[model samples]
Target chain A: MSATQTNDAPPEPGSHRRGLLWDGMLPEALGLCLVAIIFGGLAAGYLVTDYSWKQQSAAAHKAETEAVAQAMATALGCVADADGRSRAGEAPDVAAGPRTGRPSEQVELLMRELGRLPGLRSMHWTREGEAPAEPYREGEAPAEPYWEGEAPAEPRRDCSMVVTVAVRTLGGEPAGELRVERSASADAGYRSLLLWNWGTPTGITLLVFVALYRRLKRHLRPMVAIERNLHSCAQGLEQELQTLTLSDSLGRAAQGWNHLIEQLTQLHQRLQEAQGAEQADVMARFEGAVFRRVVDRLPIGVICVTNSHTISYANASAAALLQRGPDELVGRAVDKAIENPAVMQAVVAAQARSGAGLSVDHTSRDGDQETTLRFRILPVSAQSPSGDALITVEDISQLREGERARDNFLYHVTHELRTPLTNISAYVETLTQPGFDDEQTRKECYNVIVSETKRLSSLIENILTVSQLEVGTARLDVGEVDLTRLVRQMVQDNLAAADEKRIDLTLSLPPKVPKMRGDKQRLCILLNNLIGNAVKYTPAGGQVQVNLEVAENRLVLAVSDTGIGIAAEDQAQVFDKFYRATADAVQAVPGTGLGLALAREVARLHGGEIHLESELGQGSTFTIELPWPTSDQKVTR
Target chain B: MSRILVAEDDPHILRLISMWLKRQGHDVLEARHGLAARDLLQAEPVDVLISDINMPGLDGLELIEAVVPAGLVRRGVVVLTNRWDHGEIRTRLAAWGVHVLPKPFSPSRLSELIESLTSSDVTEPQA
Candidate 1:
């Protein structure tokens, strides 16, 4: 069968137009038939009335002529001779007037007898089948002298419009006919009556035509507008489907039609979903189940869009990243499912096989949290029927945050290192210059160079140690470490710095102590950072004390300083890497914020934890608690 | 002698700059940070304003942004920074028409730059 005959085939073109035209023609043809019926009815009524009018008028006309004829015959009888002389052509001896002719005498006699009647034309006498004859007085015999003495000559008259009757002698033998023509006024009356009969029906027909025309226009106008709108949409001239609405003029039909349009819109959406499913089917035919399972299990979001721009496959991660259900993403249009414009643009570009591919970042905020997803479009090269391109989405919020933190760290580290290096470099140059050959200037430059060099070396060491601690790469050099000696040595190391600032540094130890197993170098470094920071930050008269004791089966080593303490808010984050309080006192003291963080890490590595007690602007004490060594490992020295 | 104002947070670098400028026969003013430099500039105009980019209070660019517009520096402003690779800072410094000298620079070279600034006509500051 042809495609047109198939059940799945699309509707034929022009079918809507044909249907609309037919719809329009129904009312038009009906209106035309109505008009014809009214006209036909009026015409038939006019014809019947005219025929009856003509019959009645004919009878009335005949009665009028017969009465005139009878009057004329009576007049003739009055004027006729009793004897045969009057019939034979004898002149009647009537009162003699000025008129002398026989026809004039007859006319005068008839006028005198019958007087003048209304609606009378000329009167004449005629024999059967013969031309109208003259008056009886026109014969040779003279009639009585014309009544009233005078007679006028005969006037012209129509013979066809006349009513006629036979005239007879006193013996009742057939005589010549009498004829009377109707007057113009009498015929005008019949014409006016016929016109009056047709006027009413014509008026009624006109009223009905107007009513029908108005009603049909009201009923069909909305349908026509809807039809036009639909036709424009189907022809791709209009993009908005909601434009297919019927005005309220159609009443319930309008509501029903609008409802139908809504259903059609939903059907269009379903059709798009069906197209996506078909595309998925195509993809399924080309790729195996193993590939599907692998893609579904992938951590990153993977979405495949067919060449037709429908989503053929969307992995679980893709659905989750898009915040949609797994099945909701597949079998949908790429643009509709993916609300990110830049990603959609990249997908379109990839579908055209443009360039290698494009990568776009989509950032979405859900309340307080912001998620950044990177979409990379890769064009399919194998001509697989699955899809035109592949899009991979990776949630890169953490990655980007890490990059930002590293950049910040690098910036601060470089700036910190540059300060001491600049000091060292400038002082060394000053020492070389000739003006700086003096004893005081030379001594000053040497002292600056030595201190700056030491600062630079220590800063570099701190950075390396902290980075290693953070990355879990720092290997511990485990050994037996005497806690009392370690504390004494660390305090001694910071004595010169404390003395320079006039701060008292002291260490106290119990009478007896045991050496614990730990990383000795790391322990020394940790104690040095704490003691050094105490002396550097303390005021000229502030005191720092390092005390070691055994309690609770753990080594309780405390380093307390009467320096600028941490604020309550900053205390929690003071141990975080590269976190520096923005206090003026803290900023004025040149120390890497890595010290406390590194100290904590080193303490944790030896299975110990550091506790802090601080009051802003009063003092701070850092206490370390370490588990005591086991009996076999412990050495009392 | 041309008057020069040097702002640096590092005490040793500040001393070395002061020593070099003094040996060059110029009167030099000193500030420990950008805020002090702003205060000095507001007090008196100078032939040159030399500053370090990183400081505890109000950084070098901010100091220049405050003083240069008020016409405190006579010749031009010069920047000493280690943060030359910082894109936003670099762009801002470029837009200001300030000459940037990275750290670990030679004292003799710095002396020559100071000499040039004192002898040259006033360099207009860019926005």
Candidate 2:
């Protein structure tokens, strides 16, 4: 129902966390943070350890100096006693070794004691105011010592400290100075403890991290599975998300994802079902409303055939025209239905003709009736290969009969006019002959001939006019005209004709009638024909009535005649050219039988219709309806 | 006077053609159909052959095909027909150095065709 539902995977828990984890850059950030903590702690520890080590080394160097100073005081006291003293006034000669001075012997013993302390590589004592000597050892040269008035440098080994002390006799003269060197190895030992202190915790941390990673990975397995399934679904695969155990948050996430996928699948299925139903409804409407109700109900036959010459569909009218059932005609060759060679030829020619359309006349026997079929093949290229063809068959049998009747009427009329015309020509020729005499007789013959000639001319002119109307060549000059005034003028013009027939011609027009848009001459002809027919059909003392009224959106002109009316069946054929009713057969009515037909055609050319209402032996009323234009009609300048 | 051959099926139309030709001071020979027109050409010489397309037997195209190669009726030919949309007819007529005159033609059109055919010394008119 929402835009995201149509576009993306449904929302789920792992997707939400994965989105956060991606934003947080978790693994790289954790690794970098851990590395920075470890390195920063190591650096802080190194600096703190080094500072403490330097202080401890300075204390050790100070203690070593005091011990050497005590040893030097004892040696000086022994030398100051003067009992058994050496002649140089140094110390007593207490031992008989190669290098056994009391001060050197005592200094060597004190250096060995100082060496017993931890982190002491070597300890030595040097007497000042002498050549630099090594610390006195029995079998080794005396260790080097600092010269008097020279400051002792600090110990050089890492984290080591150095100290020196000066001793003097009671004579205010310098006896000797003691020098001590000590290393800061004890401080380095403490720093090493801190370095190895991280080992156990690191190992434990790694073990716990591995355990947690495996646990998290196990918990996320369902999420990964759901992800893969969702990917497949996104690609239009039908795989469903795996079921979850629902024991933890990740399990719940997987469960939620599975539920969402189920909901989406259900929605999609319902959408597909609705779409299918809609398609079926559309198809039903097309088949019911368009194909059956309309095409089948039409009077003209309709056959739709493919380019491969197979009939795809046929209407009921087509089945009737072809004298076959609808099922039998479908999927059958169109040429087999109507067994006419000319129709088949036209079909094949129409298919073969490149651009122009094909039309042909077919005569076929349907039961006892011989029907004339007019086949028109219109190529249907609206769709592809086996591009269809729409074959419309019109039953023009009645139309042919009407045309034949019109031709017969024209023939008879022409023949009838020719007789008097021939006689008049003969009379005029005789008068113009060389042996002719009598001017008065000639003049009388000429007058009779002229009248007869005029009668023939009028007959021919009427024939030509009707023929032009029937053939659709009559161009009506359309414009607005007053219907009441036009009808009044027509009635007055034909008053003498109505008087001769002794029919009471009446006009019943409203005081104000709407102006009609039409050709005045064609309207006059139409009105004249209707009025003339009314007078001709009515006997003496019969009544003929003409009325004009405005109906809804149209002007209706009704002409009612109290004459020998047409039968219900014959009323439909009255407007057909040259169709004189059977009732008029016994009556000696003289007419060209084209007046109503021409009038109907004239009304049709002006976008109007004509209807006739009549009953046998009662009367007839002919109504002509024309649409009235609105008052806002504008004329182009 | 030039001897002109006229081939027409309708007798009334053929008589009218012959009368027109005779009035123009030319000797006219007539045939009822295409086969008779061909026979006439084989037997005698003609200045031009004016024929109709839709004859009973041996239509105008076939007559032109027969006489054109045999050196019979070496003059020009003018075909008249009611079928105005036959593209094949026009192509075949042009191939045999023949001219086409559409149906419902006037008398003056026929006269002008005759005068042009006789006055031009060329055997075939350039298309």
Candidate 3:
């Protein structure tokens, strides 16, 4: 269920997360800077060489134009031409110059004519006649070489070169200086050479950059894939994987990512398990789930109350027994939920005790009735009642009632048994007296002993019957008989007792009362008991009526006695064993209290019921309801 | 002989007790239950009132309660009960100087209880 690994080599996964600068732009920008540094240095050196080449080319162009001027000057002669006199024409310019010598008038025109070169900016000669005369040239050596002419007004912004040459006659004396300015326009040949100087190196550097970029991309591809995969999986933490086969750092990084994800997945699962382990119910982790379930399913009520007097938990059985809902019981104050001071006192006492706990039985009165409860408060923890105390509240009212009943029964039986026994003992003791028994006294004593023994025997028989019926030890002998005939016979058998009391005993039987499927002997006993009780209870001259009727598919054998009747309070208990109606007249009558109880038990065993109606002084009625046998049932006549 | 009042619900037990008390040289008057016993205690001077706890009307405890104020049965009461489980009830009665005789008691035990009651003062009968 667990996997623990130790690898101390790698960085923590979270630490390696790429910052903005490190992810993509840093490597490429650094590469581009390196490329730019090397190439930029080469371009700077090429630029310096091209600047000097332009200077030298412009100088060579100007030198060539100056040489043309020098050749023309050498060809000029300042001597008199042809006539030795100045053949200065009347016009300022001659149309053609003698091929041998140059005239001053034509010199200016010829110099202007030499300005026809294509790159020529200007060709101008400064003559002595155009020079501004100085005021004090007396000590100057003929102002040799005529002060450099005022700087020419060259207006064009192009690479220009200037040359000044002195004009001399054949003897080479200075006549005037011709100034020539030439600009070199970029020609195809020059351009081809310039391109070779700078363009080739730049193109080569671009190729190198392309190769470097490819290498960087190849190296970073896995890392980028890893980052992308990790980010995409960042939400779920366990999803797609970006795998690589390279043994480089990037490949290992991928493996590391997988490992981190695995660790995170395991940790996530642990977190989920922790959440699952949380118990939302009142039963915390102190008890096992199965144990709680079993406790909840118990038939005994259980409540856990905190030291603070709050009902911390109540099981379903507790709720049902308390007649409160489970939710209503928990978190409620103990005084409110239990509401019985006696039970609460016992609970507090138990809480004050330690270890295996304490218990007390209490009877709680709810309105008119009372129920007995046994509260066993147990310790939940070492803290005892400082925490929740486990209380097992068992409603033992029924059990206490049963014990009381048994006690009453035993008491009655002993009283009954003791009476006859006492009589037998007394009479037998008298018989043993020294000659104290006369014949007549002896007969009376003997008769008393016999009757007492008979009483004892009948009491024992009835006690045995009651015991058998109560414990279900005796089974009914089921049979069918004419219920109407049986009822009439029972009444007839009881007529003597009625007559002895001077009670008017009469029978009313439906002509065709339905026969019943039952134990015929028990049915007869049921009827005999009802009628005998009626006759015995009726005063002299009071009417005792026995009516057997069939109604609603039942045989109702009703015996009503017009005598001192049982009180309304004792009616419910008339069928309880060892219970007698405690009125004066009824108490004066001597009869065991087992007849009605036995009769009712027999009736119930035969699927019937006994009902009673009475008033204190008017009369009493007892009815035995037996189910009428249907046509399918076989009736024994 | 000390005139003792015996209150019991069962007739045969009452007769047996009366006979035994007569044999013991005690003048015994009988009542079927607590009501008749209360009447007898009021109408006559008795030494001891022996009674049953459960009866139809005015049971033994009520009889004792009634007679104690009337100063009947000056020698104290002897309570006979068939309820064997009433230890607490017995204790409550014991506070009143009541002696207990459980039902089905032996004649010897009864004799001892009566002897203990009558011998306490060794005084002649007042009535």
TM-score of each: 0.59, 0.33, 0.51
Off by over 4 Å in 2: A1-68, A71-362, A366-488, A491-523, A534-571, A581-593, A598-637, B1-127
**Order of the predicted models by lDDT, top scorer first:** 1, 3, 2
lDDT of 3 by residue, A1-637 (tens): 2333222233345554563325657766877787785678477647754685677677777678778767655434342122123454343222224433434434444544565565765555555356633322334543222222222254222466777767665444565655665665666545665667677766776777778778876656556655444454565664422221223445566566567666766787788787767644334655677788988999998898887778888899889877897799988988888866765765666566545677767676889788887878775576552666778889898899889899888878887787677668767766776543678657867888998997798688779989988887866666557777887788888888788778899999777765556777767667877888888787889999888777887777788989788898988888988888767677766677998998888877776788889898888998877776533233222
For model 3, the local distance difference test gives 0.69
Best by lDDT: 1
Give the per-residue lDDT of model 1 (tens digit) for A135-206: 445445433222221222332211124666665655575545666564423255555655666666777777
| lDDT for residue A360 in candidate 2, whole number 0-100 | 74
The sequence of per-residue lDDT tens digits that candidate 2 reaches over residues A310-426 is 888888888887778768899988777767666666667666653456777777676997778888887555444566777898889999888877678766565446534544654
Looking at model 3, residue A75 earns an lDDT score of: 38
For candidate 1, the TM-score is 0.59
Candidates, DockQ: 0.40, 0.01, 0.16
Clash pairs, candidate 2, are A133-A143, A133-A144, A134-A142, A134-A143, A134-A144, A135-A143, A159-A184
The backbone clash count of each candidate, in order, is: 3, 7, 2
Judge candidate 1 at residue A313 and give its lDDT.
86
